[model samples]
Target: MSLAEHVSQRAEKKESSMTQQTQDTTTADLAAGFAAGLDPREVAEAVLSRIAEREPVLNAFYLHDPDQVRADAAASAARWAAGTQRSKYDGVPVTVKENIPRAGHPVPSGTALANPPIAQSNAPVTDRLLEAGMVILGSTTMPDWGMLSSGVSSLHGISRNAWNPALTTGGSSAGAGAAAAAGYGPLHVGTDIGGSIRLPGTWAGLATLKPSAGLVPLHAPYLGRAAGPLSRTVAGAADLMSVIARPDARDYSTRPYPQMDWTKILSSPRGLRVGLQLHAGPGAAVDPEVAAAVQSAAEMFSAAGATVVSVAPFLTQEVLTGIDAFWRTRSWADYKALDEEARGSLLPYIARWCTGGKDYDGAATIQNYQRFGQLQQATREATEGFDLVLSPVAPMAAFGAEDPMPSNDPDTPMTHISFTLPYNMSGQPAATINCGFTSDGRTIGLQVAGRVGADDDVLAACAWYESVRGDAAPDWSRVP
Candidate 1:
């Protein structure tokens, strides 16, 4: 089937689930009611109503069970009513990436071939969220195996950006970013191997954190790594991260990290070392408006006592080339193992790229790993004195819904790694916060990256930045 045909089929499959009604409660309002003893079922119903209203156009979700969500919400509400709400996320509606498993949900791994039977258990991350009293709204969509930056999937239709429906929502966390931005859910859990979470967050004007590697457990099978939570505010992101940052026995990659008192740490952003990179390597070019927005944010940091300075040794082509090789090789191996018919049904762009493994050889793969090690050494050497690095989250503001990124031009060779890919390669905690809007009215994000295992530091920097510049609330009036 063609990509469009597959999308049509997926849309038809969801039509039934999308028919449910939604409620008119904002996160703040829901929290207020919970504090005042309102029934949790009512809150869940409100969230459902909003999802029904928004899902058709945004296509943010892949699976939803209003009945199940309502039941979970009711249970949570009862706990709160009995003065037993266990965690900070009590009764909040949140969505997880489809790649992550929830009990009884199929683990598609965002691919048609891997549509295995329903998962028998929850991923460790999901368990943590449930422990924190969060109610699962549903699973959001991603590209097949999350190999693409644009959130276009053969199994699921394109996820449109909330800002401009015509523009692409940066992916593979496209649906999570759009859903959270549109308020389908105030919180969304997504993973970032490349720029999945950060790119979408930039496109949707939402706050996203790609925590340092190993800070959060990687319990999802097939993929050895993933992260979660695309939220409307830095605080919301921090809240979700805190709950999921614990060590999980099932995932050996998870390790114990410093216990975070996020609320206390994020109360202020004073005394931070904020280094700003104006240019991202040789030949890196950014839209004038985006550049201005980033500069404006640097100035805000300076006003807030952050030492913002122009710096170099940002990201070298050698580092990004190595990371690209790693992604391609891993993806090619996974794709080749798919059933013949299932492979045939994949989107052409994905099939073509994944199957084209001419550039990767055994020696090349080993060298790539070694190159990454050298890149990490370089990063550590240059970033030792700074607490955080600030840059434009993307080279440009959100693009047309049909096109999430720029054309694959050689001059803009580093566009894909503009501000996000480096952190993933370095395994450092990085986040994006809404700084301001362009004259054309699209949102611009300020990227903040901290030392490895400094997830709390990244959040604190975002909190401080937000406090100084004020919230970048969605201008509903500008919605197309």
Candidate 2:
């Protein structure tokens, strides 16, 4: 055969592999459905129907246009029919968080502080997803400046738990979490600086990953900030990760990394060194139920022949307080830039929290900066000897939908993030998988964190845990 024929044959075989599957909206599923001649318009309509059913109570989106969704699906269907589908994910619907820009869409930044401008271009990750032929559903909602760890947003209104509408879906990826749990579609892209993605992953009973800082490209990369995937299953999250992590020249920070074989992201936990952390050094005490769930999951590893050891709390109040101080300074700068009316539109809770930036002198600000470094060093030291650490994703289950955070105190908003924050600064890859549930049916998350740049292993460990967790995983497809 000619070279061109060989390449075409390869593509055909690859496409054929995705032909037999279900209609769950997972990338694999959608790809299979498409290969079987399933109309992309039908998939779009089903997802829209789901959104209509869930949106009124969940408030899980900032921009959800059925017209736009239909348009994108039509384009994907055309590509598939022409045998020029962008990638294996063609026709799969996915939602982008409001803060992550898609060309021509306004990034609201999760606050009512001002009318955010329409982005003139796409964030690198967004471009990659579009290139892969994933249909964009719309932008999801988040809390003010993504500062709070709950669903109450000043601009987008409050997003609620998918499991129970009265409860909050953890923020700033609030809408993504709710959408995933409600099965609005297969993929939900979110960004996390502290615990935004995983907190919501836990609260909403989803699988999510916070890749190493530079592993997934971001437009304006900053310390600890990363773009990642949130989905109902690890396989779904992995499908999105493989695409978003593709090299992009715009984000120079995403460089010099070996190509990953995502198929290898499922391994046995046997013979692996594991550390168990029930208490985050200083923050909200893990509720008894939450702690028990984590502990039980850890014991499963022990039973599976993995060495499990308890690690001492490594965080300090000084570091937590200082990091908050630095963030206060950053947000305050943004607040000061706004005109009087725009500033007045800011969320009062966040305003009360970060306004103290004015009080910090140069020396104090430097001191706060030092605290962030201390946190980075301390987190590294705490998880140094272990291959992976198992911990509770949150102190408790979802809180009231209207509360700004789990603590309900702006002064101490970082309280629930202790378990998941350290990995962000250390640039370690961490994942959240449902290990158990609260007494009332809310899900509890088991955090699997690997060393810095160990994204694949972190995912593998999460997959291993999920396999062993058995029926504990929620039937999101069938769940209400």
Candidate 3:
């Protein structure tokens, strides 16, 4: 039978009582439900129903197949009912980014110009998640080529923040953030090159971890390496990371790290040195409320017996210039290859910058890479004594949906990098936690970054902060 027909058959067999029970349970609660003999298929059906009802307005999902999800869920249910649930993520529904390949799923990577056929095999990370028993609901939206920071995309359209759909949800993992924040799914897999994962988490009031470069594999169909989770809590993010963190033969860049037991290690946050820095460069423009929220989080850490110190050596213009040059130079080939129609379809700012191709020369590219290396070294030196660094996740909360990012300033401009990209360049592990809310009711995030191999420390710090300041649960009532 066709995929749609398969889904219809399963939907027909779904019991009303089972639907009610699954609909009422949280993602964590659903895991508990499976533990209690509840059917995984029922849970998956309820999740698909929730997404069907909510996605039309949210625009979070780019591709979905209810039949495939039902089949996977039924298999998971059988495993759970037989006392053989394979992994920690058993029965959980997750949204995968378009850039990550899932066998038989169309992964256009958000480019309207190119419609690559459905993938023939799963990306290594996707395989890991499936092996761990998670059900894939659909692909989430992201920027064309994953180049821009704003969540607007020509291929899948804009993914607005869940708190207020009128505002931007941040990108390139835009739709993943919206889905998690809107409760379309409890877990979302996203990529980060610039502020992709953390920025969206900040705007949508979700938790996210941009694992240290190489912690998660990035393979075919994904040009750059990035795979992380967007979720309602830090522990949930950690759990997803643990499942996808193993080294894969497909990705030569995958780092060798001990497999983490998240439940055991992240049970409580203790013995961590936290450093707070609001300014990263000479002209870092930090929104007053955002800075205040970050400071308040630091104070909470102090009260929780963690050392909080103000550190300088913030992100400098030189550092940003170098990073920008690196991206332009590295992605130059890809931009040039795009046909005019595809080029025309991109967000204007992205099209302008990406297509420019004249800013940095070969020598400049190498120099920028060298300069970035120095900055990474400097960051490591400055943060040597600390276990984690705390700061605002973004310069401000979600901007208006119509005007996603400022477009005028280009050279050494003081824009939204106050909280994000530095960590990306540094290749350090970073996470965003819901620190508080703006007066306008939009969410604000506090960023915690750890050293190269300190992914667990970052997760633990977020967990500590969450314990003191409770998690900001998504407002389902506002979900469209």
- Top-lDDT candidate index: 2
- Across 166-233, the per-residue lDDT of candidate 3 in tens digits comes to 88888889888888877765778999876789889888888899888888888742322468988987
For model 1, state the Cα shift of residue 330 in Å. Answer: 1.5
Error of 1 at 7 (Å): 42
Q: Estimate each model's TM-score.
A: 0.88, 0.93, 0.89
Which of 2 and 3 is ahead in TM-score?
A: 2
Considering TM-score, where higher is better, how would the candidates rank from best to worst?
2, 3, 1
By summed lDDT, the worst window of 10 consecutive residues in model 2 runs over: 14-23
The candidate maximizing TM-score is 2
lDDT tens readout by residue for model 1, 212-303: 88878876522224595788777778777778888888887666777866664554445777788867773347888888888988887787
Indicate the worst ten consecutive residues by lDDT in candidate 3. Answer: 1-10
lDDT of 2 by residue, 373-424 (tens): 7878988998999999999998888888888887767777788888888888
Judge candidate 1 against the unseen true structure and give its global Cα lDDT, from 0 to 1.
0.73
